[model samples]
Target: MQKLFKSSHNAAGALLVALGLCQATPVIASETWHWHGFVAQGLMRSADSNFVNNDGAISAELTEFGLNSTWKLSNTVRLAGQLMYLDGGNRFQQGGRIDYLFLNWTAINDMDWQLDLYAGRYKNNHWLYSATRDVAITRPLIVLPQSVYFDAFRDIAVGSDGLAVTSTHNLNFGELELNWSLGATPIPKEQSQRVISTFINGKTEQDFVHQFSVFLRPAQSKSQWGISLLDSDFNYRRVANDIFADGDFTVQRVMANWRYSEQDWELSSEVFQERVSVYGFYAPGTERTQFGWGAYLLGSYNLSAQSTLYLSHDHFFANKDDKRGYLLPQQSGGLIPAYFGYQRDTALGLSHNIQPNLRLKMEYHWNTGTGRLGPNVVPDTVVNRSRHHELWAVQLMYWF
Candidate 1:
């Protein structure tokens, strides 16, 4: 199945490239084609923590360069894709990747409603920022709230390789939008180790991820409300001499979000509860199920035409039943620390536009607990020993 998906993706990319080449002809050159790109570099530091680097030194690992293009094949069809190279230190895998490459088709269009279909690697639009997180200037903060946008799972959560559909309906009272996606992301060995454990010596595969979401905007109102649902499955295959056994995981999530905007200020929040079931992995026949929850509230104000300020609070717990993590150490036979069970953060950020196409951003975070850090399957006790830590970053971005 993975091989088939890869082949299809390659074919779609080739077709898009061919179409782009054909558009070079004067007859077709008139067709709509747009290109955009960006370059961003930043400095980050994590004090009393290994979130950025184990040595706890200021790092210049934050780097991003992306190029994207959209070509209109016809009035009802278009091809869009973005290629990016990123090195975010411990945040995610470092390398070049296709952020999204897909063919979008307008399936139905009318005065009151419209439907669109997508095939190939589609971008995730279920979350408020999921669709634009790849662009540095589009994000509100240098580092987003980890409770929901955990950087370790960036690639897998950004999108999937398969199909998606979106529809918008105009009603007497408001406008409603619905979205659904079914797909899977190929996991590399390095990413698997980051998500599971560095000790893992096996291949991790995402079987599928099914998601649905709905959004509503009432007439004459500046507020938007939304709800999203997600279900995913994963499997791990161990090789010879591996310490852990083959494993299977099932994850389900329900999320609710709201956003309100005024001329100068904006507020948004999202809360979610998730259930995770694990089988084997640690040892043969080992099984467990845990419920986790996360939430974040953010507010931003436009200080001026070229400046903005942001504030937010974020929280996450590995087990809702043990928010304080008092039982975590006990459950792990004293090997895991209590701090591994939860994480809470308060952040402040500011962004100034140096020019229409250039921007500078800075942010500071006061964090408690280490639940959101990496090597989650097995806590990295040595580096993440502190329950309290701080993180700060400054970035400069340019785009055209």
Candidate 2:
């Protein structure tokens, strides 16, 4: 992994230079093509031994760079894509990776109705920040709400290789946007280990993962509200024999989002409910079910054109039915602690625009419980456990 990290750093340098040149190059055709890119570096540290990543100490692992481009072939056709390199501790993949590549076609383009069809690896558009979360400058915090944006499946939930159709209707009041996507993507081994090992006590390899989503947003004035239905189906194969079983895992998620932005202040909130089901894993006649719920409330104020301040509160439950985790001790044979059932986080964030193309960001998080921490990175044992902790992060980003 260290060697891979070194190689990724070298590649990132070269890509940065190339992206800078591309951004500087003028567009030959006025309305045909455009290119832009960004580079961000950050430092994060937590005051605990829990596994946010590698001992949870101060680390210089937060680095990302990307190049995005669009080619407008005609009035109704365009090719849009992004190539990105990301390494953000254990929350995401550590080395170079292709983020998204897609083609978009507009079948109906008019003032009242618009339809778009996309194929290839398309970005997830349901969540409030899913579309642009990869770019550091666009996010309001170092980490988005973990309840909705669980880090264990960060890569898995970001994009899918399939098809999507988006439709927009212009109304007298505001507008409505509807999107539907379906596809499958492969899960990396490391990600599988991080998420699966805690629940299943054996070595597992992903067989196939399927994803589907439907989102609808209605907007009026300066406020927009949306509801999304998302589904993920995962199957695993046993590599080495152990106590855990090889079977199917399915997750169904329903999320509601609302945002209001006007004048100098913005308020946003999202609530999600996730249902998890497992089949043929523990026993032949066994069926297990659990439901998890989470929500976040965020408000931001623009002090000036170049500076902004924001605060957010986020909370999550591993099992809403057993919020206290008393049943968890019995369920896991007393190996896991009760506090693993829930987590609550409060954050204060501020961002300052140093220049038109450069920005600085700082944030602090006061967190309770480790219910959602990556298990592989942070073992579920008392020796490495801390129920309460604080995290501080600083980032600098530049884009052109």
Candidate 3:
């Protein structure tokens, strides 16, 4: 029965991919309106139990479909939005949801200088790949580096509702760009499970979550360097008075990125430090702070105009001070193991452009440690005890 289920799921995924390819339409324009979209399907399996749904079996829950459009109301102002559907197992909510909706204004545009403003739900372009990562073809791997681009925070981290500004300067040497956003968005129940109710069964509701991000990129020759800061405030409320208490969460993150691309070779690296503060959550009048850090280096080479190979090493620690999870057992009275405090991942990926509108990627990941595992998917810590795991995935994406 299990084998039959897996085969059926893979077949459905393949059918979806084929339908997407056959039906994909190019960016259509009618005078001032322009539109485009993409669809992707992925089949994944883990050698050992992991956090994503039904870990030991081949699963096709990794799916993405989106439609985006823009209306150029004027030369300087435009309306833009997207409707997206994603089913990433425990990573995201099932079914469809509006990804982003916004109006863009070109406040200033001149030779070597540009300024833009946006109001509404806008994509988070601060991270190296946050803005386009939802589209499989635009991403470097089926799953992004888990340390910086965690799956649990996908919806909240992808975009926010409010206001943003962007500016660019074309310098004699190269270019410089600066962007910042401030807004609020609701946090889904699944996202709150990771932090709010670690061991208990509960649902979480957030009236609103405030988020802010700022990014600066300076480019010279064939290399570009970026610095970004992301911060958020969460006001959480437990539903039905579950074993969890209502509280506030504040998260601050700082990251640095550098990339060099020339001809058929590209090298990219990013390092980040994060600080999380919890108030009145664990106990009344109690405040705790945790510091974590992670980094990744990726190198890619184009074998031909239609194929590419990539290799990356990603490492992260829940607590930088305790890289080995020394105090976890003591703190939890041996209920939780120390290996749950960090994760080390190494990945090899290959992608081929079968056609201008079709692309495929095959990738493998070797992971050590389970610190970054999502509790919502693999709620039982015992299932993650192996500390060493492997994942193999293939994704097909079609877009115009």
Candidate 4:
């Protein structure tokens, strides 16, 4: 069943690639077609933890390659797509995947307002950096703050397959933008093991994800503020002699974000509250629900025309009521450590433009707690034995 599911998607991806290439030959000299791609490689290491490798060895797992194109079918319609290959070690699944392939229609355009609609596999534009997260050069750091952009949920949160709509209004006080999306993503076998548990032999499927967001740019200001809401559902079916039973899960979230920019510096922040409910996963007829909250603040300054420095502080808690994590060990009969209930980190980074189309980036992190690690549902205490850890990474990237 899993093989069939994967092969079908792979076949679709191959078809899209073929169409793009075959059509490009005929329209190569036309202004209506455009394409771009990027490649990046990095070395990363984690100390006193298994974040990158079990033995704390230097690893070359941070790799990304992508190609994307846009072809204008008509004045009001266009076709856009991206294909990517990624290997981020323990962060998420590895190999090739279709990031997004969609038809965009400019439904309305006027002096006062504009509207756009997307169908097929559409990108998630609700989050602050979600739309550009796949491109290494567009990100602020080698690793984003895990409190909000948890790596474990990268594939599931990146995008969805369905429909989306966006509308923008130029108002008297400011500009307002509204977005809505409804869709779901397929969860592959490797992702299931990384997100749920390594011991389980089962299939996990995302039922649906519904999201909405609104942003306001106050008149004559260099800042923007936005708010978003999301609701998603998932189900799991166990195979023979599996460690876990059939289960259902639901997640709901509300987030507020703000960004400010100046000639030489920038500031951004986001805070969110999430609620998760689980049924029949750990045991039959068992149910549990928890509310968690997280936030991050980031600031960057231009050191020179070709270099920049940045810093960030991030925090997350599994249960808002138990911020210190004392209750976690007690509830698990001391089998789970307190650190597993929360995670906090401070990061410092630097980026330098080696040339117009090439860049180098380096970053270091001081971290506490293992709450953000995966197989998140089960908590791998045996491998992530330490509560305090340090990580550093360096990468070089090129684009065309």
By the TM-score metric, which is better: model 1 or model 3?
1
Ranking the candidates on lDDT from highest down gives 1, 4, 3, 2
- Candidate ranking (TM-score, best to worst): 4, 1, 3, 2
The TM-score of candidate 4 is 0.95
Candidate models: Cα lDDT each: 0.88, 0.73, 0.74, 0.87
Regions more than 4 Å wrong, model 2: 1-30, 49-51, 198-220, 282-286, 376-379, 382-384
Which of 1 and 4 is ahead in lDDT? 1
- Per-residue CA lDDT of model 2 for 1-400, tens digit only, reads 1111112324434543443322222433357777777888989887573445647679777787877767778888876666777777766767755555567999998889999998766788878888877777788887888888776777777776677888888876567788888766556666777776554544443333333334434444677788888776676655465555567777888888898888999999999898988876665555788999999999999999999998999999888998886886797788777778888999999999999888999999888877877752224565236778788888898887
Q: What is the lDDT of residue 399 in candidate 2?
A: 83
Model 2 scores a C-alpha lDDT of 0.73
lDDT of model 4, residue 360: 99
The TM-score of candidate 3 is 0.88
Candidate 4 residue-pair clash tally: 0
Winner by lDDT: 1
What is every candidate's alpha-carbon RMSD to the true fold? 3.2, 5.4, 7.8, 3.1
What digit string (tens of lDDT, one per residue) describes model 4 on residues 333-377? 998898988999999999999998889999999999988887778
Against the hidden true structure, what lDDT does model 4 obtain?
0.87
Please give the lDDT score at residue 267 for candidate 1: 98
